[model samples]
Target: MYRSAIFLKISLFFILLILPGTVACYAQSYKIDSLSLLLKSHPKQDDKRAELLLLLATEGMKFDPKQGLPHADEVLSFQNAIKNKNYVASAHRTKAGIFLYLSRFPESLESYNRAITVDKILKNEVGIGAALGNIGIVYMTQGKFPEALKYFLQALKKQEELKNELYVGIMLTNAGIVYTEMGDYKEAMSHYQRALSVFKKYKHFVGQANTLGNIGIVHSKMNNLDEAIKYSKLAIQIGDSIGNTRISARENGNLSGYYSKQRQPDQALKYGSIAIQKNEKINNIKSLGFNYQNFSDAYYQKKNYALSKSYALNALKIGQEVNVTDLKRDASLGLSEVYTALNMPDSAFRYYKMYKEYGDSISNDQKKNEITRMGMQYEFDKTEAVYREKQILAEGQLKQQQLQLALNRAELQRGLQQTALQKALLENEKLVSEEKQKQLIISQNNEKLQSNKLNLLSQQQRFDQLEIRQLWLYGILAIVSLLTVLIYLLNLSRIRKLKFASTLQLREAEQNNLKLEHQYQLSESELRAIRSQMNPHFIFNVLNSIESYIMDNDKRTASRLVQKFASLSRLILENSIKSLIPADKEWKALRLYTELEAMRYNNSFTYSFEHAPEISLSTILLPPMLIQPLIENAILHGIIGQAITDAHISVTMVQSEQTLIIKVSDNGIGLNRTSNKTLVNVVKEKSIGLKSIRERIKLLNLQYPGSASFSVDEGPEQRGTIAVISLPVLGVGSGEI
Candidate 1:
């Protein structure tokens, strides 16, 4: 039990260590050398020097973390020279990681705490969450399960607050590891299941591999051998696929143990041998010891006393050297069993006594009690979190309802005011009409009185009365026109106000929609980046090919292939991480990819790319890898399997009005075969390229609606698949600055 416990503890510690980590990924040799050269050359210890020192500490640390210590110390030594608080945090984190790798727990914790303090002062919530998680890892390695779980949950809270699903998944996985150590299988499974969903959604390979491996562990602990083997195989599969030797090695070892428990010596020995090889690569001492023990169990089960005794002795020797009590106890007990089988009474008794002595210090019952208590605590914490989330959701809904009610009331009030103003205008028109009629009657009465006067005076009176009547009629007309104009103006203003309000609401809605679309685009862009990356399978195969060539002493071909693979990989990675790259860069990358495929397949086919003379590739910006999948489909599906001599793929890009029309045509077996499947289905089921391209095109069309399209059909003369992509070209600023 002690041996198994130690294996689980140490294995989980290493699992958590595989992360982007405190500073960043370790640096390449050229980058580290350049930074070191700059540091040596630069006289002033200013911002540049601070940056160089930190880079050297972080990037160079992977090569020799101990050697990187002075660089980290120098960065932290003089804050006056390096005013950047970020440098202070980075330096601390680098120092902490280096110490952690070296198993210096106390110094690692101190450095991590310093980083957390700086992050707190800076109010950097993301940094704080990351540091807390790293600290939890350090604690876990120290065998402090309770404290590790506490810190893991704390970091989970912060990551949840930030809505960073990737880190959230990492924290959940760490918590699961703690729960597993606490002997709470139920809680461990719960956390692991949650983390698995997060990792799958984000396509985080490392998280997925770690979670799968740990879940397999939980099953193994529960005595579910079949499930344990199942998940362990899965973890190994993914880990091997991704070239992650650390977790894969452990899974292989675990699988060996499972087979040993099942009494399948052959299966057990197979996995045990594999585990030994992998563990030796990384010099994983604890795993190696356990693997040796498991290997011995296999041979013991087979009744091969000589080999069994030899392996058991090896395990005992390693256990003694490492001073692992549980491993020693298990190895000694196995030796006792083996000796008893061989009729060696004295040796068996001696080993049995040793095992008893080694077992004296561990208390299983107390650990079980602690596990029960922590499981209850974990459940309570989860319930409380759900309650808080529901409460916050309710509050947000209440606020939204209040806002909507306010808007409705304002709209109703405006409607009523407009109705009242309309009524008032109508009443003013009626009053003016009545006043004009009364004035007309009064003017007629005055005209009759002037008829009784003399001829000359009547003539003068007639002239004056006619002029007064004309002026009176003109005044009445003017007043009527003014009233009409005022009513019209008021009505127009009311309409404008309504229109303005409606337009404002519509604009707000559109902006919100655009905001949501932008977020979606960003997420899709990242997914596309991941999808567009060179396949791990392709990379591994090419490397294998290169290795084969080197083994055969074909150095020139091997070198060329190596260069092509590297260049193609760099270009694809550069293009994938961005929404748009230079058209020519993408074209060249695709060409390189085609060449690598050809070289890998023993020059099975050739390819060419051409752009119109009218197009300036440097100025034209287009999304990366639009035509990549098509080319891949053509090469892999259309040509590679077929017996077609002089096989060639031609790609052409020409400016057609606003569109940059590109075509990829390959000469091989035609796409329309007897399968009765559409080209899309062939692409979707056979590979990820076409589906990813479709999604990418859809996302692009959202930003520039209907400007991007992709299609696959037979080429001219119906020879093979002809894939076409239509992209709306733009100026240079369309890509990342």
Candidate 2:
């Protein structure tokens, strides 16, 4: 019977050991399944159902956060309806998972604290440990390695007591990732190796692949190119065999990065392309973004600027689509580098500034989360103390009743002390759990804050890119406009010069035509005046001769004189109408005039005509009837009335300097003082032909300006007049007749 009693005690001990675990497992399953069903239901009940939903929601969150969020909301609504602290805490925990997945890290952190509060109130050490582990993971994601490690270690102790190896391994792996990011490759490798061993012992292929890929990434950061490539390739192969394309893509991208760092552009490009293809096939937008970024780097290394820019832009697009803040930040950096290489310093600087701002924002967010987490831990500890006190009071009441009936009070008392110690230990563990949960919450919040900062940076980069494009467009337009204006101005200047040249030519031609017309008019007027003067003189002389013949009654002499006068008159009239007459013709006219004068004087005067040897009579030309009047003046005025010893008048012509020099001189009683007046009057009244010659000279001077000159002067060595004339030396046979 004593053996049976001992067996019963052993059975009770075994039962107690298995009971908590089984109860915890059953409760967790019930909660998860109930939450899933409640979420699946089209409609929910009221506040009481909401409390049940909160319990289920927290349990469901471990496996399926997407399914847990609505239940969490229901629980929150129930807490609002009933003001239940426990329900509020459960809702907060469930919501934390949802928010964490949504990247709402600040809200998730707050929710995690609320959950920790509920766990403290219930004095649930395991729950607090689990929550702390999750918080540690969040911190790891945020790169808060120190804070995350502290919580993780605490969680590790709780998980060891619970013998939860899988969760412990996951936490270990996360710790490794944080260390790797911190550049503590050795410590990171150790953590990863420990996690890898645990995963392998459990036959967790996915976990193993993840750990291996992370190890490769750490090696890559350390610049162990060969080891990085080897491990990455192995991870990719394992992931591929297991149909885990997400892991495969990640590993491929890492390998590509390794190749890129080694400056093997071809190999980098090959792996990067494969990674992109796999990511695309799997519809993994986040992985695709990373792969595109890697490809951009590879192409950039090859100096393919256009392709590099395109891929970088594409990576940015995918990162935005996936809402992957880290990817977006990376893509923006790549794009900035591309622009910098392309000589777009402004764009590069803008993106770099955006990167810095986002980084600062991330740091600020981490600080806020850390503060909140510490505050929540403080609150959880207070609540846990209250729960511990309540448990002690209940144990004390049970012990008092048992003490009254005990035969072995000492043993009973020892057992009571042991139980009290155990209770005290549980309380200590609870405090540790609360501390760990706070640390994890802080870490998770920091991670979310970092993600938000990265997103802001990406948005700023996009804006900068748009601004850059606008600047380029404006610059191009301005340059084109400036060039166009320059061309127009040049064309306008050329046109103005051309017009000015045309106007100058026209003016020159018009001036020449005006000069020619004036010369021709003057020549015609001279000819008319000469004809008018000579016609009247010839008529009066003929009439005078006829009358003298009648008075003398010598009919035959009168008749001969009249006929000669008529013939001379006809010759003079005909020659006056001609434009030019030969020099010989002008001499003949002078001889005729002398003959007529001799007839008038009746042999009182004689005349001689002389020509210089240099004068070519055949080629020479003179104005018509110009010499006749000059001879008439000498004969009529000088020789007619004077008693001259030699009544002879000589006409001589010579050529000098393209001019005609003619002298008609007579030796008679030289002009008396009263006779000079009479000679001047006669020149004015009867020397119309001389006046015509003067007008012709004026016309010639106007026509050929400085080219011709005519003047009359007193004879140098004779009592006669000399006429000097200059004309352009026209070639032989070129003179007008």
Candidate 3:
């Protein structure tokens, strides 16, 4: 929780810092002020004036992204006088950037499209490549990875054709990020390596550092912490040597993260402090956010939660100010962790919920396979555009809904005002009638009642404890008395047996006694075998899962699983040795066992049991603890990872011709999934419980020919498993079919 809080805080800090920092790095307010002064002094509707207008807009945007929107619009108006398609395209591109930074995605795309159209008409390959790259970046911000990658690849091809070395390296790096996001680590590394080579060959120190930083990120995701640290240090060294403050600051944060992950709090703090100092020097607000987040991580590792919380808050504030989803999501998550470390649950919940909302925006269903088809190729045809169009239309509809919601809130506010006025009148009436004073007196009496209730509970607890002690004493006395009575009865029986018969009669009785004792020994052995039905493997797996939950600090899930497992185990042990149990008791054990497995596997399938129409659960009998292993097999191999929505299992029992038929059926992947295994391996790995059941079936058949049978086969649709067993009905004591 503490670590997550730190990351979330840092992300937000970057967003807020970057919000006012992007254009400011290139042109301070003084440049914009001079441009504005020039514009005011020279007012002429011509080419020179249009240039002046664009210059002012571009300069003014340093302080605020929207500051140049009107100026750029005026520049576009002078296209007739300018007579240069290149200049017009440049104006559209400039306008698009402002909208992009403002998160006006639709406007940005439309402007970029206009620029592309002009570039295409004029055969401006460089402009086309640049616009395409920008478009891809916009798609990336929206989490449309496939669409982003498509454009980036196209831009890379064009840049290479044009011999634009810098853009080629940038495009390769962008593609690497898309691959990384898609979880293709090997492919991502390949792209990063190529990009790094290109940057090094061209002597682009900053680009080389950036690619190295990306490689470090992939290594981090793959859990190669040492490799991550190695690459990060190399990146930082390059950036520092070249005096690239921005790259240096970002790499320091990366180094700090690796050190924190390694549990080296001192080393992490050292790098984090360096990053923060460097960011402050450059007035890089976004970098400070990243740096502060590293501080949060270091402090959390040191167990200094107060400082961690402070840094996390700063990161979150910056993220919100910058209006970046990544920043906001991470900031909220980090903040949540910080609050959790502080033992503040409410605050933790609030930030965690915020994190979930932002995360969903990036990882929702549409971004799955559907993302792969978005804006295929560089050309925007009707068929290829359906996905992007739908996304844009949906976003627009959501915006309208938000606007309507604001209006609804205004109406609600008015209603609340009216309700408050009515309540005020009621309060005045209450004051006149002394009702308020009566209510206060009643509240005081309730408080006194609460205290009395506590006292009563304490007294009741004492009485219960005394009664429990008396019951224990009585139980011990009863056991002692019963043991004495049993000894006396045994002595009397022995005396009765002392009266022996004639020699021949005694021999005959002795033979009969030997037969009965041999039978008793066989029954005891069978019962012990029944006790062996509990699978050690299954029990061990359950224990392991419980241990994992505890290790993860998931107390709630661990406690719940442990309780269910304990109850199910108690039931199984109690019933396993019984010759016959009530049908409902066996059915309940099966249900509980299935529920435990289902919970362990995330409830990937549904289950049910069906009893014959005329069957009475109370009257019918079933062998105890005999059906659970069959269901467990179905859960593990049949449908454990199946994705179909209708996957399920059904157990049915019916009586026919004095024979009880039981069938366990499952709509699952079936046995073919294990076709690759040898037959011997399959049987051993598939269901050890079934092997035990086969032995029990053999023992049952020895009593009467064809009295019991079992078989496994394909279900109705040949897409699942069906196991059937037949047992002859018997009278409890007589044991007659």
Candidate 4:
């Protein structure tokens, strides 16, 4: 038994060196080698071998599920043979992972519970955390996202404390994917971005690609196609660079969908084909199914009804084989669309009905399962409460017994005192009798009285000693009670300080969040202003042209220009009141102003608004009346009274690095070399609009610090003022500054 204990401690020491999520093939081989040595030394080392086998099985599950299952079975058999309860618990956990891969969810759940029980008995925190995380994965696979999230969060707290960054990133990405499925894009993006940062920092290329792919999916859902494309391309690039076929295939599918949504059918088809080919090469059933669905959608957009139908059917078959309900739903939707396009009403209706039924059934099943789980949880909590109550009752009984024992001791002490008092009285009487006898003789009478006085003095001394002992006992008890009170007060003061510190930390975090939100809002407002300014430049230029005609004494042309300028000014003023105007309306205002400005300069200067299809003017919001000042500055500084017939201005809005980059550049003289301050400070001091923008940016910085920025510089490869404002990409529901 002593040798066995020593061997077990040694094995555990080696296990501690193997980090979670890093037990690769080589690590498993090392563990196996160690197990063989242990078996040779201790011929009856079945239990130790079983413990090592469980770890080996877990490692194998990552690469070879079939091989892992046999290892798990072997571990379980050894545990049963040796009747080792500790190994039995761990064997169940290993078996659970194998069962999960086999899609035997009920058995997996049971095995996980068994592992949890054993871990609890062993006080194994890491094992408990792992079991919970695996259970969460099971829930996720069954489409129970909320339940999965609960367990995942619990596991995450433990893993974070353990500083298991690799597993932490994986869990974060999983949680984010669940949120994406639930349509909580903002939260999903936050998690995915955090995971991406971790993966990049750790140089985990595959993890980075996966996170980027998920981020792309979120942006796609939010209708930010350009951002979706950007992230998807990044994922593809990283995956390709790392030679990770799985990530490459997945990203290809994402890009296909992004291109299809952007109405780029040719690019969509190209990527969809690449995804399918890569998935085929890797034999990834999940990726293959998504690839087929993407191809079907791309084909449908291209009006290839026959090809669309074929791909959709293929996707449906793959989805059903894999039991991927979401994929099946998408396939059905795609088939319905293809049939409708082919003008087959009856066939289209059939697929549509099937799609609706499947969707409803999935939803109903989820709701029922959630209700059942909640009921189970409530019962478990009730049982726990009852057990706690019993524990408390037992403790109370023990305390009562202690108190009774103390009381009995005090009573016994009093009884002893009474007995001593009786003995003292008897002795005193005896002494008095003896004294009386001695005093009988007439000549010895005085000597007998002196002896009686001496006996009384000895009795008084004994009584005083007893009194002192009683007073000492009372003083000790009083001091103990005072000391206990003092200790409690000291503890209370420490608790108060802790509470204050916690409150202060919470307040600081809230203040920081508020600051970030304000900064985001300010950046958003500036973007709107830049967009709004695009229109007024053309309007003012047209008015200037009409002034030129009036000075030239062309009354008819001047009158006609005045009428057009008046109408344009009214439209601009009306549109300026809105946070966002239609792209066409903004274009019209820009055209009118551009024309007027051209007439004023005899068509020597030119300007244009370059629109990207990615910019959805209707849904996008900008700050009202923000752009005119910059354009005015450009005209006043760049073109006015200048001999530069080649002068031109351009305004562009594009999203890059999760920031909306708005640039206003011109072919004009650069900043005055004589200025003592930077352009930003000069704007802050002299320009009301710029100052307002700065104040707004400051407020936004409070909310989204370091997320948005603005700067004024010469355009790259061009000699002109470039006023650039970079705002974080905010969603539709995001409010104005």
Candidate 5:
């Protein structure tokens, strides 16, 4: 009865002291409801909406912690949708608080870290400091004192840079709490004293109260009972003055522990019950469980075993609900002590065994956390190394690109110089052609003059003959007349013979000049044909195929194709200037060309090369780039054009005594089956390569009768085309064949 009276007096005193703060809390609740209504009415997405959401989250946390989570999530969603990073950081920080309240430490840390990252991007120092402090709190909850201390000090430094006394005080108190938990009372007291000074300087009552409560915990740990009591009472008075149940609950719990150690059971019970009520009202399950265990100990000290057992059970239930290992450990110890006091050995033993089991579990969990931390550190180092390597590679690539650009500029300049040189050559050729035309006109004029002179001579000869005839008749001498007639006839016959020989010589010279002009045109056409073999479009397509192979990681195939391309290029460059090349050399170049084409088309067709065994390749002579163009036409116009899936080409050489028959056949669409008239016309008209070869054959035939002839027709199956060329066996000029 005396204990009940004392508890009643203490409860009444606390109620009176907290009455004003309670009314203020009621007004705050009204503001929260008004904000909720305002948020619902506002349809516009703006900063106003973000502000209202934040307010709702902060106010909702006072009564229903879980209620704040949705509001915080909405804030994050709204900020993210608007692409406002600064506000997003705020929203994340809010969510971290809600997660922490829900006892989700990992989620809390994740959210706080995300907020810090955003703030860093924005260069918002204040936001970063706050997030760091919150992260420290999460680490502290997980019993990572060193990590918690590190972050708290970092946040304090940032706060100091900003000269934000409130946050500085709050972070210092947080750090002090971590030190106290680690049992370093001296270091903890030093931080608390510095924080107390900062809070006092700023006149921030909440920061002051929080720091005071932390200081009390440190004092209690050091067994300084008087100083601990003084700090605890001062913190509780500050909390009651502000109507903050969270602070009051935390301070009162501290006071209850102080009183329990002083062996004042009634006073400890009084304060512990009040703390439990406040924590329960605010949904602070963690603090409520601790207060309950403290109440159980008070009851045990007072020899009230039944009540102690009851309170211990209550504490155990709350610890289980919250899943706080520290709460569970404390509850188990209290229950064991209570059961022992009640003389229930079995029950005591059971709880003592549970306490040891929880202790071991906590130790294992700490070890696992240590390993996880180490792994995270290693991964962070690895990621940093990779980032540095990528950065260096990017810089090197930039330098290489610059060098390539310079080279390209130099190449472009040289090409311009070459174009200028070509222009100059064209001008010189124009001058030469004009001079030749003038010379031709002069030669024609001279021939006209000579014809006129010849006409005059003939007229004179006619007159002289008439004169001689008259003289012979008048002088009466038959012999003289006959002799004169004979001489006239002889002179006339000699003149006619001389004119015939001169005309024959002039005709031969004109024929020789025409032949020379035709030969020059043929040489120019052959150069064009060799260039056309590696046309821009075909080269581009091949390059694209090489790129695809490289991107596909088929480097072996790409390398082989590149080498073949180089070989083909070398052959074209070397043979383009020559009129004729050995049959074997030409065949090798053809093979390389075909192989590259096949690889470009992903091996779409197969080809074979065969020759008569009786013929010697090295001893045979053929026009350079003669057969390749025919094979290309068969592939591009026949197989590729018709999209033949099972296409084949065969090149065969047959020796027939004096003529070498070279045949190229493909199992592709025949001439009659070709549907694109335009393409067919293009193939025929633009086949300068084939035309050039035909001209060369004509020239060869002129030199060596029946040297070359070509024809094309449908293949044996009527499903493909074949090109046949017959060239005389003019063996390598040595008659080796």
Candidate 6:
């Protein structure tokens, strides 16, 4: 049993060393020239230069480990000159990764400790988590499984605190690797499963591939070859789709071994060759050694002694160069088999002795006892399941708190509304009273002036008639009667003019009040539109769908859905901030929103857009998302509500001289089922999207009076609804600023 344990330990350590790691994923494809240019532009010893240098070093570490060391050294040398501790910490972390890649365990551990100290001083949680994980990797490589688990768990705790799902997944996978090597397959699988959940949640493709590949390895160890092949292929597929060459190579190598175990030598050879080619392309020496060993194993299974011997020698060369203990052990085993098959007993015995020596080094009593102790401790704690229970409880508490906060916000909004209404009422009453007071004063002044004018006219007549007394007495009396008639006519005309002027003033005041009321309505409608854009129901439904995917363990789909939802929300927010946007921008936002809505509801309907060739979408400007509400109503009411099958919504744009016309038509249970009248007629009962559309049109027309118009009516035969919006052509499309 101890001998078997020794062999298993050596083999597991080799597998861990050869497997592609999640940490190296951050070194994804980057242009060295771009980094060089950036560094050149930033001056020597500058913080920005140091930052870019670290990025370049990170990118180079996995592929060219030696090249990255000098870059890391340069960063450290410049750190004292730079003020930012975070940069210095990142530099140390980069150096640690390079040393780990080069198999310098002690050096890597030292650098990681330095990084941790700097990160602690800077309070950099993420950096600290990374350094901890790196240190753990070093310990794991050195066959210190329990010690590695300690570091991994510590890093995981930090990752959880930061809520960085991707890093958390990476740490979980690392812990699982440790457990697997400790002969605790059950605990290993549990951690891998949890890691898969997190990777899927965030759509971390590299992490997903790593976790899947590890699960396959675990299954392979359990002698479940079929299940091992299933997961290995899945890992390969994900890696291929995401263009992760290194991960794909590692999975292919695993598959090759799996097929070889199943005695499918031909299939084994095919995947082994593929792994070799990919590793060559990436210049991955560690993975190359593993691939070569798998190739030797496949050929050995086929009884091809000569070819098997050649491949084993190749693997041994790489193993010797890299100095990985597990690789050399596996290589010796393969060479021994090749020699035995070739009928060379002496050579076979010599290699077998070397393999035994390697196994002996791996199975020391202290290590075996440590593995047993850690496995027992893990089984007892059931840490992951307990953590999940705690998480679920905390999530429930958070939801309750959020609900209370929302209720409080609603109450505050209601209070503000009441205060505004009261203030408006007071302002209206004050204006009305002031107008009445001015009218009363004008009436009193007019009456006094009229009385004075009449008295003055009478006095002038009396003085003039005395001079012409006896000779023109009859003429004077006739003139006084004519003057009296004239005075009465003048008074009547003045009174009529005053009444007409007062009526005009009253009419003006009424028009002003109507304008104010319309303005208020416009504002209310805009607020409603903003609220609808951020409708809680829609958000809740999207979140529910995402939750469903998470429950189903379909992380990729769920992550994609979340991304689309976020993009739609961002567009809505940006549009709300702008009164007008280019037609193309509005179309882009509407299209994204339509697609997201369709996805949320399981693609129950489809949509398309048609723009007139003559219209320049980039130059034409319109109110942002003006037509989205109408489209939403068409889908929600006309299509979804009515259970319309194969429903299609079409948006068409046409430019005619000085006017731009947009039409939204949907083939669903048309206007006859909903309403026979235009959308305006049902405004009182329709959604805020529709009501806001109406109010917006009114406001738009006021701004450019008679320049915008919209009408909603039943389509041909009333089979569906058609909404048409017309706006004055400001100019050719100039694109959005």
- Supply candidate 6's per-residue lDDT for 157: 92
How would you encode candidate 1's per-residue C-alpha lDDT over 328-427 as one tens digit per residue?
8888898999899999999999999998887763345337538756686799999999999999999999999999999999999999999999999999
lDDT for model 5: 0.76
Worst 10 residues of 1 by lDDT: 10-19
Q: What alpha-carbon RMSD in Å does predicted model 5 have with respect to the real structure? A: 46.6
What is the per-residue lDDT of model 6 for residues 425-448, given as tens digits with 9 covering 90 to 100?
Answer: 999999999999999999989989
Off by over 4 Å in 5: 1-30, 161-163, 320-323, 357-737
| Cα deviation of 50, candidate 2, in Å | 8.0
Residue 668 of model 5: what lDDT? 87
Q: Of 3 and 5, which scores higher on lDDT?
A: 5
The C-alpha stretches of model 6 lying farther than 4 A from their native spots are 1-31, 59-68, 161-164, 320-323, 365-737
Quantify all predictions' global Cα lDDT against the true fold. Answer: 0.77, 0.67, 0.73, 0.69, 0.76, 0.75
Candidate 5 matches the true fold with a TM-score of: 0.45
RMSD values, in order shown: 25.8, 47.1, 38.3, 21.1, 46.6, 34.4
Rank by lDDT, highest first. Answer: 1, 5, 6, 3, 4, 2
lDDT of 1: 0.77
Residue-wise C-alpha lDDT for candidate 2, range 1-737, written one tens digit per residue: 00000000000000001114322444535656555565467244554465556556545544444656786686666464644355565566667766665445567667777677777877766567767776765555444545676777787788788787876787678767655655567988998999899989998777888888788777766667798778777877787887765566667777777777787878878877887786666454555666777788888888897898898888778656645456566667777788899999998887667656545755665565556556656877999999999999999999988877685787789899999999999999999989999998999899899999999999999999999999999999999999999999999999999999999999999998997888577667656656553657656766787789889998987887777776766766676666666666666666766776677667787778888886777677676665665676666656666566678888887666866667677665444422455655765565554556677667766655676665655554545455545555444455555
TM-scores for all predictions: 0.45, 0.38, 0.40, 0.42, 0.45, 0.47
TM-score of 3: 0.40
Best by lDDT: 1
Better of 2 and 6 by TM-score: 6
Pairs of residues at least 3 apart in sequence or in different chains that clash in candidate 1:
none
lDDT of 6 at 84: 67
Off by over 4 Å in 3: 1-80, 95-111, 160-166, 237-245, 266-291, 317-326, 353-737
Task: Quote the positional error of residue 552 for candidate 4 in Å.
Answer: 99
